[model samples]
Target: MHIGVPRESDPGQRLVAATPQTVEKLVALGYDVVVETGAGADASIPDDGYVAAGATIGDTDAVWGCDVVVKVDAPTVSEVARMHADATIVARMSPDDDPALVEAMRAAGVIALNLNSVPRISRAQALDVLSTMSNVSGYRGIIEAAEAYAGMFGGQVTAAGSTPPARVFVIGAGVAGLAALGAAGSLGATVRAYDVRSDVAEQIESMGATYVRVDAAAQESADGYASELSDEQEAATQRVYAAESAAADVVVTTALIRGKAPITITAEMVAAMRPGSVIVDLAASGGGNCELTVPGEKIVTENGVTIIGYTDLPGRMPKHTSQLYGTNIVNLMKLLTPGKDGQVVLDLDDVVQRGITVTRAGELLWPPPPVQVSVAPPAPASAPAPAEPAPAVEQKARKGTGVLVAGALTALLVVAAVAFSTASFASHLTVFALAVVVGFYVVTGVTHSLHTPLMAQTNAISGIILVGSLLQIGSTDTVVTVLAVVAATFASINIFGGFSVASRMLAMFRKEA
Candidate 1:
């Protein structure tokens, strides 16, 4: 099958559907790739780059005429009408309940895959355009905030005085929210984040931000996305929001619901901030999380607070964002072209592919079969009851038995030293006895669940012992020499065995596993 990459006609778009790096991947999969001349120019990619990557640079007609047409935005109806029947067009088509585009796809008999529709399941994460773009937007939000703010993000300690770090409050702990909070924290800013889902609190804290606790967000997210809060709950949350926003030096909002972002920062909250403070609204395209945000514009409040409402945060950093988005396309291509034989196969049985497919077989297939986004956690096993404590008399008897065994061993060692041992031999036996007792206590203290970690620690100890014993191998005393040899042999075995077990334990943590 032939794949085509056309130049984006939209003036505001700086991203390309495919880049030089991704074109190479498509060609490696046995597909002839065609790119429109200067398609990647906005992203700082030259036409020669695509050509060097095994893509043919061609005119608009030549590129769009391929069997599969890939794009960043949804192609217009006129553009879709230009494609030949049975050809496939793939893009991040946020149809937004548009019937015209679906009707056009049906009439043209073209296969349309909307990257925005990619499932939220773990297996489909690579193909998810929303989260991928949102991550870039989140990081870019912090940069824009820093640029507009008067003071530094990080606190400074100079000979003159000490400066406190700027406090950042982020609303919504999703991909964008986490990224914003992390970026802010990395810049030495104090960060705080809040989410309607309580489960994300740990994630927020892991990013070096405090999770603002709210009692009203007692909701479970079964679809990998936060569920809508009730009106009463939202009001309860707004009450807490006022306090958080008031204390923040820079505020970022990323909450979205049904394509509309509800207001979390009111005008009163903006008025409470200091004169030089800034607010970056990442959800501006979705009506904004700030009630004062003007979409696609930056404005300063009368009180000297800056409110930024940028719809193109991802476009601000085009080079890397293009690469990431292009790679997502390549991954989707890899899934569709399983055989690497230049054939496109639409396997509806696969959830990832089916979820992105909007129109196929001369019919509109928007809203594919519903998939369960969240995996149901397995039921935990019932724990066994605790063992009852032994009687006081029984415990005392066991302790007495241990003391007797110790006394007998000490007597035997003393008799051996007095009857047949030299001073040198006695010193060696004393060291050996101490080693045995310490090793026994250390090994016995470890629980079964911690055996692997214990092995890791013991491995280092064995290495030291092996080196020390090797140094003592030339001792004149035969007993000392033999004991040294035995220690070295056992320590060698432990070193190798411990490494093997440790490697297996690390393999269990690999991302693929």
Candidate 2:
């Protein structure tokens, strides 16, 4: 089997798909490895390095003509035309946004394995290119924003005066947002983050940044990505952005709705910001989070706000990016490589293969099936039917027993109510505390799998509790009113907190595009 490592032809794509270390591994796996001349030059890996690792340095045609070809970006129409028929190409093919690339690969009869389509399962984490790149992009965005701003990130006290720390506001709490938050906070900037899914508050706070709360329901899809906001929710978010941006020295927007453009930072919000404020839009590649952001250009508004829209932040650190990307490629290759023979095997039955296999065997399988199909075995023979129920007399007897039990319960409740009316406040409080303890235990008994639904249900129950507390707010007793207000406040927290937890868990299931 022949595996080719082609030079990345995309503009500003310095990261290569494989490093010499990865090339050596592939060579040892019984494959003839060939790397294009100067393929890894930008990433600091010379042709001599590839040669040292037992890989032959070849020309563009030689590299693309191999049985397996890998590169950093999607193949261009011209590049696809050079690939051998039925050759498998592994790269970050943005199928959703680049339908033409999918068609091009199909027409060229190449099996395109898109790294971006790798599932978010535990086994696939080592092969997640999107995550590896996003981590770099997130951290780099902070650096870009800080550099573009005229002010300093950390506060300093000099003989002249004290310079205040920069205030950073991050929109979206996904992988990139969290990275930006960590980086900004480490630089001594006062950071705050906002997300449509409220569940990321703890994560945000964990990074030493405050979490901004918005008056909106969580908008997380089942796959764990943030869904499009409703009209009212968008309005609320815009208001929050306007206020936050006005007070922010730097704002990093990483909010991305898969397959759609992200516009979390509007031009109006930018105009509201003070002079010298910086806005870094990490979603610039997919349109951008800021309305005024050009895909690959930086611009300063008349108000003196700088919007940095550089798309390939990961490429800025090509060495590390290529190292991480190379490991991801090697990990994915392990799944496709069946044995020491190094032949590429297409196992559609495997979840990872099914996910990344966009085109297979000259057929365009773009947007692979959501779920794999499985055949169920035939059932065994069934048992005989049971006998019929008892006669009407038995039914009447059962109804009589139920009425007796109900009447007995009603009598007991009446006696208990009379006793409770005369009981002291401490005794009533004891009963309430005991009920809370019982409820806590009941909740703890539920399995982890049901925790999200349980939390949601408890949130609704807490809202009801808030309503009851509200009714008591106008009570004649001062003590009763004060306690009611406290109860209502705590209930409100529980309701919001419950939604936050559920939203966070849902977000975990979102696969990278």
Candidate 3:
């Protein structure tokens, strides 16, 4: 029933596991929360704020000793030693799978829930710390690149000279890569992006960056991740990566698959880059996508190129990142505490819970059964494509249908008019019947795309009907009066509804004041 927030022991880590916002959520879930003093200080959340959210401030041991302890990084050796037997710990556990740490948790009787191991399935996205961290890292990575670059990002047409925009090439069109593309594009940079999954080309272009297409037929991934490429495919993709990175003013590499990161930019590629060009490797924490990237350090190559491999990009913006991470944990907590009784009840059979359970009750339960993220891509088409019908033929068919229907109806009405109407009334009936036929075909023949404008402009006809109905609203015959009133009521809607839609559509073209 007691959940705890522990201060991040890593000096470089500026994020907190639970902010006051998340603490309030925990309290609402029927759990008493204890916050280690100054745990959220790095993220600008004060102890008083935690108290206001129904959490009590306590020492490190007091907080860690609670039934459920939350953290940003994997527990350190000394940190894990302080945990009481059967206590649960949650964090974005490292992928290295260190044996010593595993043994320590097992000996301490700790239940370890690795947030990084949360499945990529749709239901588990809310608790996925990897994506939450990557979302912030992607945006911050661009800012980090701008800081290292020598020139401005956007173009300037000054009286002195016209400066061209900086060119930014992003490798990997994952969450981080797409975010980098958006930030770079917003800064007026000429952005271009590449991804091994050809299906993400539309997503890449939607971020306002050109998607570098490769002459290959790669289907969408089976698990929402980049699958391992064959040797020949890798070589072809690498050629494009090298050429783009070398030519760009700023290159960002965000390729990370499983625990290892492939070398996307090699030494020869780095050497080919122009002087003062900057490269930001977002996958630095997971080894690195760039050969020159030194994890946790920024190094300048001999050719005057800056290679930034900062592993704490998300931590750099502590406030927002902490909130994002805390919300992710709160989502996981909500799932675990479904009864709202302050008790942690995990459904081990569930893919999400089973996947996150690294060590439970002194037993290692990690490397759970693989979860299939998506069904296999459909088999290719066996038949060849046929040419489309000619536009003239298509147009002729549409015109024929409406006219034929209207003419048939008109002929039937003319026969009825002749049989039912007197001599004087027959001529009036024929004229009205002709008008109805012309109106029917005219309205029906318009293209579907023009319906909006047709409705807006057709208000004049509706107004005529409304006026005609109004003339009969005072009819002496009771049945005639009721029918006329109903017709007027329906006609008024067409007139007013048309005006309302037209006004709303016009407003879209006007500038905001």
Which runs in model 1 stand beyond 4 Å of their true positions? 377-513
> What tens digits encode model 1's per-residue C-alpha lDDT throughout 170-253?
999888999899899889999999999888887887667889998888565665677788988889888878988888889999
Which order, best to worst by lDDT? 1, 3, 2
Tens digit of per-residue lDDT, candidate 3, span 142-252: 999999999989999998999999999998888899889889988999999988888888788656689898885344566668887888788888889888987899999
lDDT of 1: 0.86
Enumerate clash totals for all models, in the order shown.
1, 0, 0
Query: Of the pair 1 and 3, which is ahead by TM-score?
Result: 1
> Which RMSD does model 2 reach against the true structure?
13.3
Error of 1 at 167 (Å): 0.9
Q: For each candidate, give its TM-score against the true structure.
A: 0.76, 0.71, 0.74
Deviation of model 2 at 452, angstroms? 21
- What are the candidates' C-alpha RMSDs? 8.9, 13.3, 9.8
Point to the candidate with the largest lDDT.
Answer: 1
Can you tell me which runs of candidate 3 are displaced by over 4 Å?
Answer: 217-221, 377-513
